[model samples]
Target: MMGLILLPQHVLHSVVHAAMGVLVFWCCTVLGRSQYQGLAIPCSPEPSPGATIPAMCVNERYLFLLLTGGFMGYTYSLRYFLHNMNCLSFPSVQQFKYLQFRQTVPKLLKLSCVQSLYLTRNFAAVYFFLGYIPRKWIQSVLNLQMDQHLPPLDTVRGLLDLSLFYQIWLSGVFLLTTWYIVWLLFQIYTTEVSRMDVMDGIRWCSYRGLLWTDLM
Candidate 1:
């Protein structure tokens, strides 16, 4: 019997890389242009500092995209962790079976405590990124004018513009910070923590975070 494999967390690892590629392309190429429009496009196609990336300083938006992409990648990891936590049934130990594991049927499904904790953090991100950071980014458009001396900065409808372009990036960033919490909770009471040393589905080596792979 085989349920969905969730451990060693390699299933959507490709998604993590794909998201990175898409983020960079969208931010730096497709929407990227010669002129800066308030929020409709965050950065220019230019890789060099001459690109005049906005957000008060040149190339600032590029920094934001990289940070945002990194956070998004980590968030995907959280989703993978949560999937493993919910799946209680061990169906097939295919991952470790071929690896010469002592037990042919290692934990096919794993519901570890650390994964549960990650799930909680993911839910919290819904509020942190979309709800809070968006408002902050929107407000920053107004605040930015005061700091930077660029003549166009004063005239652009920065408020309305952000929703179209730059806010989209912030939304992703909200995805990252939230998809990104890692800390150990010490429960003096009963602790419901379990870990799978080997995964059933993982193939082709992956560095699923230490917090996930390491036993709690």
Candidate 2:
């Protein structure tokens, strides 16, 4: 599918997935060491006497969970794209029509469920990773310079600009691919219901949220 091979999109996805994988691997290794011998590997500087290295190690486990969840999400998203394209690429119209009547509905529903689960897991991972990691650790890890006051408006503007750039790149690919997938779903739904009007309903509901977001 043209949606599947969107140049550097796949490459960026691969890099993020690979980085997550490596982070998970390292966390697992650290966790193994910590579990077997009660060894506490120091991460950054000790924040306090009671706040031991083991705590940091545990936090690393949470980070690993986040990364693992992200990796799973990205992996499943790729699989969903592949499956959708495969269905679309079927040579025989008869086979495609038959699938629309029967197989496509169930398959798409299952994929939708899996995608939702993966997305939820990934979000959960990010929540815990961001919430639990110590601020000092984050600063050191990111090599970020701290400001005494809140960052200036210009700094905020710059951050927003960068975020928008990334969002446009990622979301553009996702939306295009998802639109085709949704189109296929509509075809299957219409076939089952014997109602072409359902497509308008589906499209309206799907784009409604996007419309609101764009307006905001």
Candidate 3:
């Protein structure tokens, strides 16, 4: 039985990893595009009453909304891979019960929360570490004027700088984190092979315990 299931499991494992890689690449593209245009705008000083807003600053919320959507897409794809593994690892009748157990358990609950938190944290952490902290320290040391009335693009430029360096750095971090997650999931996939053996042991223990109770 293990031999029969092995081939399909390998195929599924490959497919899941491939899909995750594609999603990661897609996410990087979307996020890069969104930030590139906005971050390119230079910090413009106070403008006249009729001055036009920079193109990058306009419709800003829409870009972030798109970025959030792309992030969610990748996250859902990851969840699907986990669910697929559960299905492959158990019989149809037992699968539902196991899934419920996994979902409701505190450890799994913490895992889900951590995964979701990491998704949001990556962007914020990159900005804080590479953009915000360095920029603020430099400005303070140089005694540069902090313009309060600056545009959105200008503010982001001040925070993240107009250089492509931060963008590249952030993208590298994001991609590396994604690759780590894919590798971790693959480890889980391999362990699932022995899941049935553990289940059998559990069943035998329960049966023997019940028999002893009946004999007494």
Candidate 4:
């Protein structure tokens, strides 16, 4: 009966992870294109007599939107993964007994540690790439002036300075903390159940009961 219940949940988890992987892959591709091809604005040809100048390309804006969307998608997927894992419950004592009681606590702890490292690295990357370096590069490469008065460089700098990165960083941190709490809950659950097993010898009793019931 536990197997019947757990099988579907495990299958659903696999499906969700697979879908997220695909989404991440697609976002990487789009980001690559936006980085290489989209950021370069072509020089406009000189206008003939009375000819109107072509509108400037807004490629940077488009790239910002794409990257923001990607970050949001990845964050949501991570949140869903943690949420589902945390909510899983053993329906009966038999199901709980079958859980790899001794190993579950260690496994959950290891997974939590790994997840924390990954998220920290991701946050650091965002902080460096988006928050610090890109802004500096935009100011330098675009030759932006720090003056309050309107200037062409300042206008260009404003166009390039989409704060999507900071927004995404805040959101990612929120989700990561939420997931961390979920992992903590799983750890607590495992520890409590393991201690209970020591007190009750639940696994051996459950197995013996199952054998006799099956024989009848």
Candidate 5:
């Protein structure tokens, strides 16, 4: 009665978001500085090239913090989808398990599929910002320190750091690809296969790409 009123999907979504919020906050608090070490602005007065603001005055902490927050949040969404799939594939209970497989699992799987595709859309946005915003700012700062003396080509090269862009793109792609793979695995588990064997849990973990090293 109350369960129908409350809506399990809403509850699960809220719990996932709340849990990820804490995780992202902790990651930003602990690992932010190290992550942005390459772009750290030293305390020095320097006339930046074609720059209005001083080089030393620009703060980039907020940029890295935002990136970390977004990255962790979407990453958690993928993990949540995988967790739901694993739970759905677990060996059946003596009685209620069949009921859940018939009734609850489909609802949860549908919700998870939506969550995964929705979260995957954020990959481009996150990667774009990481490339065009934070990296751009770092380049501008570096150019400012150079005092516009460098050639146009060199300046352009400095500003458009392909390596950083590629790294961010790779990370985003990794998360998105993982979600798709897991989503497919869950789809197969639910539709193509009906029964969960004793080895199902282990097989599910393998499908999730949980390697021996990861378990260790």
Candidate 6:
């Protein structure tokens, strides 16, 4: 019999991760538009307050939301994957059950608690590493004041300041985003392969078990 009744794992992961990539792209595109980021704002010495760009774009909050929500789903998919993978790695009868990730890492799938922790961690990372430290380094090296408060995006200087902050933020978050996509791909690849295998196994077992016994 076929090892699994499924599509190619590579193709599956590509599609799944691509879907995630597209979503991130959409969010970024929306936030980075010329109107929003002050890209096309009329040249002025003063900061223009035409449309307030959400501070989340320039900090770790959005990153927090993006990763926490996305990873939660990724991990949940893993739960499903393991359930299927177990059937083949260690076959079991219908009456048997297996313990999962929770035993090793309690509340791993609890969304509320996990999200709260993620938010706190993201804030700390931004304050110490991703956002604050890098900006400070750049300001000290370039002799620029990165502490400008909500500079109007309509002016050249204001736009540059916002751009600088966001660039640093993006540079940091990009690494995590890349890894998250990779993680998604692996989960999809293994889970899908195991999905079909488990199904075929169940079908074969059912031949002489549930349906067979019932029909007989």
On a 0 to 100 scale, what is the lDDT of residue 162 in model 3? 33
Score each candidate by Cα lDDT.
0.38, 0.45, 0.45, 0.45, 0.46, 0.40
Q: Which candidate, 3 or 5, has the higher TM-score?
A: 5
Best by TM-score: 5
**Over the stretch 1-216, how does candidate 6's per-residue lDDT look in tens digits?**
123324376336534644564355336545655233311222233545685642212322233234333443443334334446323342242211223222322333243344434533444444443444444454456444332344422243443444444433443354234543444345444444343234677677877698777887
Q: With candidate 6 superimposed using the best TM-score fit, by how many Å does residue 143's alpha carbon deviate from the native? A: 3.9
Error of 1 at 32 (Å): 5.0
Model 2, span 1-216: residue lDDT tens: 655656587656656654654344344445545321222233444457775432232232233333443455366446545665434332233345555546565665565555544554454445444533443465467554333232221232322433333322232234333534666765555545342333467789878978999999
Q: Quick one: RMSD of model 4?
A: 13.6
TM-score of 5: 0.31
lDDT of 1 at 213: 75
Candidate 6, RMSD to the unseen true structure: 13.6
**Residue 102, candidate 3: alpha-carbon lDDT:** 52
Flag the better candidate by lDDT, 2 or 5. Answer: 5
User: What C-alpha lDDT, on a 0 to 100 scale, does residue 62 get in candidate 6?
Assistant: 33
Clashes of each: 3, 0, 0, 0, 2, 2
The number of clashing residue pairs in model 5 is 2
Candidate 6 or 3, higher lDDT:
3
- Residue-wise C-alpha lDDT for candidate 1, range 1-216, written one tens digit per residue: 023334344546635644763465355433545243233332233246665655433333333334444444555555545555323443333233224222321221122223323433443344334533543464466453222322222133322334333443434433433332221111111132333456444532344555457854
Worst 10 residues of 1 by lDDT: 181-190
Model 4 clashing-pair count: 0
- Please report the TM-score between candidate 2 and the true structure: 0.27
TM-score of each: 0.27, 0.27, 0.29, 0.28, 0.31, 0.27
RMSD of 1: 18.0
Where model 2 places Cα greater than 4 Å from the true spot, the runs are 1-6, 9-58, 80-216
lDDT of 5 by residue, 1-216 (tens): 345325677456645654554344444344533333433454354556787865542233334333544654545654655456435444434334345446655555555455534543464345444544654666576663322332221233533544434433434334334444555456545653465445677787886676765777
Higher TM-score: candidate 4 or 5?
Answer: 5
Candidate 2 lDDT at 18 equals: 47
